[model samples]
Target: MRFLRRHVDAVYDALTVRRSRFVRVEELVIRAAGVVPGLVPTPQEIAAEDGSIQRDKSGLEIDQGLFLSAVLGSERCGRHLCHAMLLPRPEAQALLAQFERDGRVKLDGASVHRAGKAAVVTQDNPRFLNAEDQTSLDGAEICVDLALLDPTTEIAVMRGAVVEHPKYKGRRVFGAGINLTHLYHGRIPFVWYLQRDLGYVNKIYRGLAFADDAPPDEFGGNTIEKPWIAAVEAFAIGGHCQVLLVMDYVLAERSAFLTLPARKEGIIPGAANMRMPRFTGDRIARQAVQYERRLDCDSPEGRLICDEIVETGEMDAAIERVVKGLTNSGVVSAAGNRRAFRIAQEPLDMFRAYFAVYAREQAYCHFSPALIANLERYWNAQSRKP
Candidate 1:
């Protein structure tokens, strides 16, 4: 075992120096034996230890230990010397075989070519589709091919598009793009839940609260105004338009259709519907335009906030369909979209009142750390007063 250990160390060292070389198992053993005196164990001895060597297997049966020792030394140098020492030749071969099977082993050019050919044969099957269909399918197929060549290619493409597109260049466009990108990438799943599931219930709560607590003078006040809204909206609309254009460029380059405008009305349509249920309905299409609040998914109102949720689920789908029908019939948008939106007094009032409450809630939440410290000080002062 000591002889084998020293030989393994020598083989590891050799592997680090000539990592690019394709060394045979016998060659590695010969080199390792030369480095460590009295370490030249016979083939029979190796077979006895590993139980994998056949009587007829002579003249360079692959020494998995040598290969592994080399690989470890090449990849991590001396850091894995202890691990290499523990793993015997047969054990190492078994591990190498497993790595190869799992596609975890790095391939040289010839190996890569062989694998690529096999993948091409498997994936590029013949189809009886028409020319138009074939053309449409080609883009995704090409994407797959590129992905095989380089896994990070898609991310690179998206990053490049975001940086180069005019809409993504400006502050407004960048900010909106960031928000949309975060949502699309599932970075803010909570927002979707809130808007889709509990929106309507919260809207009712807010409206009732507003009517009961707020004065009539608060009705038409510019309480919603904020300096950041205009900039953020502009950026969002511009970024959305740009992204649409990029997608078109890649997917439908020759087509000249326009994307729907990003709603810059200081609210996400779906989220606003949480405050104004009558306007959005259960489908929540208009809520896309009113993205003001973080969506929560745990509540019942949150179920209809997203496109997939609204389209497929039982209650959500049914509500969405009805809303779509009404919109198509011009019942919802008859008085011009803006004027129609303002027609529902009760829901709108509720939405505004809820917005105010939400803002206050956020403010208090933000100040919680300071508030706690202040409370402690006040308690101490009260003790002295008594």
Candidate 2:
């Protein structure tokens, strides 16, 4: 622990130092840890609290806070500590290049529409119920970056694109979560999610992109100080449900249900582990994330995650009402207020350190034999056609 405590920053510093090549996830984490080492925990810590500084298990005492908690009380975008992980790296670049070269998609599965002060980000992959794939991740990154970058976009609303299938009519879904098909086939890269969570999703929560002189993590850079409202309907599955925890407010249809499905899927649920507890508290978060418990948007526990439950077909009106209501003050304190709340409730340092654990451990669970077996038994993923 002593050795790690001393060298942890050096490892992070060395790992994040500009390089021509992107390091492998586990390699980067382990190499950075040095002597008393461990991979970044991809799931929630097997046994650590959010702000906790230490833990002991398997006869090993571990502490990464010396380096990982650098974001606490610091204005620095937690990104600096995690090494700008959200930025597309080498593998991401190549995959995007190949996808484009094949003419596979014109849009990365996400589109942004602006009207007045609101920016609507539609996650459009109806074939997968708006499930996220590499393209979708890239698209979300682009859309979110666009929303944050546009000074006129005061509030961003995230929703899924219309589903083409007859089964669901034309109703939109918020998201279906990670693309299990791509994941089962090994097409979704680890960094895809890393970048999604740290890169764009955090950008949604933090409200800033690239501006050289924006004061550490300030929301400048031609950026708007925006708070996001999640408009959820139909299926809000897995990573879909996970992201709601980060939103400023959620307007959901009464018919909508939320679930992590992580227990069945055999991989991590992005940053849900870190942020879910803040909305639903520890017990509900555990039940939702660990047991695959489902919450109806109108339920008491669901209300904690969702601010207002609109009638089944009224999500559109609810979204407009909520967005207009929020911006009614028009003072632009949303960003500062959001920052204040996060600092008190779920500080960036705790999240950064949690990512350190999530980065390594989630990789293990992603490819574990148990994951395949769980999918076979629960999702029938073995027999389901992509």
Q: Which number leads on TM-score?
A: 2
Listed in order, each prediction's TM-score against the native is 0.18, 0.75
Q: Which pairs clash inside model 2?
A: 40-357, 40-360, 41-357, 41-358, 42-357, 42-358, 42-361, 42-362
lDDT leader: 2
Tens-digit per-residue lDDT, 1-386, candidate 2? 35444554545446645433334332453444453335333224423432321111211112232223332212232445333443333333444443334323235788777755787778899888899987677677766666555556578888988887688868888888987866665555454556677767777776553323332233442234588889898869998887787888888888999999888888778888878877888999889878889999889988988898888878777888887888888846776787778667665566676776675566556556777677667766656556
Candidate 2 regions with alpha-carbon error over 4 angstroms: 1-106, 209-224
What RMSD value applies to candidate 1?
Answer: 29.5
lDDT per residue (tens digit) for residues 1-386 in model 1: 34434454445556435333333233444455455434444445444433221112221322333333333333233223212211123322443444335433221100111121111101111121001111222232222222223221111111111122343342111122213222222222211222211221221122111212222113431111000001011122222222322110111111111111223311222223343344236444343433333222222333332222211114323333433433344432231332233344433344334433333233232223432233234323222211
> Candidate 1 at 281: error in angstroms?
4.5
What does the lDDT read for residue 126 in candidate 2?
Answer: 85
